[model samples]
Target: GRKRTFLACVTWFSVLMVLCAAAPGPEFFAVVRFLAGIGLGGVMPLAAAFTTEFAPRDRAAVAYVIMQSGYPVGGVAASLLAKWIIPEFSWHWMYLIAALPLITVLPAAWRWLPESAEEQSVAASREERRDAARAGLRAIFAPGIRTTTVMFWVMSFCSLLFVYGANTWLPTLMQDDGRGFSSSLNFLLCFNLGAIVGGIAAGWAADRWGSKIVVTASFLVGALAVLAFSGADGTALLLVLAAVAGYGAVATQTLINGWVTRSYPAQARTTGVGWSLGIGRIGGIVGPSVTGWIVSATSGGTAAFLLFAAVGVVGALVAGVVRHAAR
Candidate 1:
């Protein structure tokens, strides 16, 4: 019910943004962006909760990987569309172009997505005359869950740090190193392409092995890839490193989400997933800001990459802790 209300509000705000774009000013644009961000923020956790509810018992990891992979895929498409249309049309047209997908998908989602069975079951259990009270949010803080929760928070922080920081600055970093704008953009393309491949592969691998090992290995590889990306001088090397970094950096998100799902019971699953992502948004905000600040201070991307590499190392250690705790 709350999700539905939030979605309605976001839709209204989006409509208002479109209607007001014609008479736009700085204030208007700011309002629009703020509204859009609210809308985007609500969608992710809702989708994650929905995915967890509907996914098969054994295929939750694959479901999350596929869903999360859509983020980068949408980004890639948006980039391509903006490049093609912004020159001929205007920036407003870009918004219009993006809205088309929403129009199509909204109806489909409404029709197809199932209500969360966990939510229904919880409500029913609460009303049952002889039912024993099940574990609640407090269970998430129990010793068994506390460690995994902390580890996931750390992994989420580092994964998003690399995902956002690298994607935001990688092109500019390449261009600063004497590469052309086209080359820089191509690197971004290759990076997201690698993300798609890596996400699927990581899901399959995690299902076979365990999410802990996959996450740790990904961070270790990502740390090296980011370092290599910082020093990549040739197009070939840059592309190769971008692919590696994308695989390690972006795909780790899938593992983290899967691990979190397994750690909590259905009753607390939404809260757990929401809290992890909410805390990780802090890292998301910090990653780009800190990277930008370091680049400004040092006048080089090398220092920024080194900082991110350190973050990845921390993530690797956190993954190890999570594995130990799970045992």
Candidate 2:
């Protein structure tokens, strides 16, 4: 169910991305972008849900982490492309290039992606299907789940606050600290690169140790990384600290994803992860704006980094309290 729906959503997403590229004016572009974002929104959570269903129990965390790492891997790829496309072509051309996935990847996914056994079970009974649809909403917070449900939402929120905050502003913060524009953007490159590497490592660790501790440590270490960056001086030192911060900041999401996917039953997994993702997007939207306002008000990089560090602290504490059920 998630896979077929995913295909449908990505098909629409590609169409919208093309529409965005060809839009004649700001109003049209904005509308297209909104619709495109709606399509884009479904891809990840559903992918996570689908991945959870197929992943081997013993290697669950690793499977999810490998999938999750693609987020930053994609960001890194786009950043590299931007190096060439933004100058040689226009922004619309970038959108057109993004639309390439529809042609190249969609066909391959259609051919290769398996429908989960869970999807078949739902289809087997019309009466059961209705019950499942109803239960999906109720099950995430059903008995024995309410506390963890709320905890997961909070963890997702706090994790994304710093994740998106760093994504949107780290370069700007670097620029404010006197690095050149290119150099500042390079920090973003470094950050995402570390995210790719760190996500895999975190996933492997989570599989071995459990997500609660792993995620908590990620938040604490990332916070410290940001603090260390505030004191960093040389270009090499700054990038190194940025990489460390990226490692922790981005890996936090990886751990949560694995936990949510692992913890929720298939009947309710989509709803669980979907709601968690929706909550995190709220924080993601607020994060950049909040950081921007704080930076403007304080007029200092130290204040901004301190604010993000504090978010990490909050995330760490929240993560520490979320216990893994024996399931």
RMSD of each: 3.5, 1.6
What is candidate 1's CA lDDT for residue 94?
67
Per residue, candidate 1 scores C-alpha lDDT tens digits across 1-327 of 324644564465456546445636878777776766666666666677678777776777777888889877876786676556767787777666555534766666566756666666666543541231235456567776777777788889888888889888988888888887666777788788788888888888877787888889888988999887776777888888888888877888767876776667766666677678777777888888888999999999999889878988999988977644222
lDDT at 298, model 1: 97
Cα deviation at 45, candidate 2, in Å, is: 1.5
- On a 0 to 100 scale, what is the lDDT of residue 116 in model 1? 65
All candidates: TM-score: 0.87, 0.95
lDDT of model 2 at position 12: 84
- Candidate 2 scores a C-alpha RMSD against the true structure in Å of 1.6
Which number leads on lDDT? Answer: 2
Candidate No. with top TM-score: 2
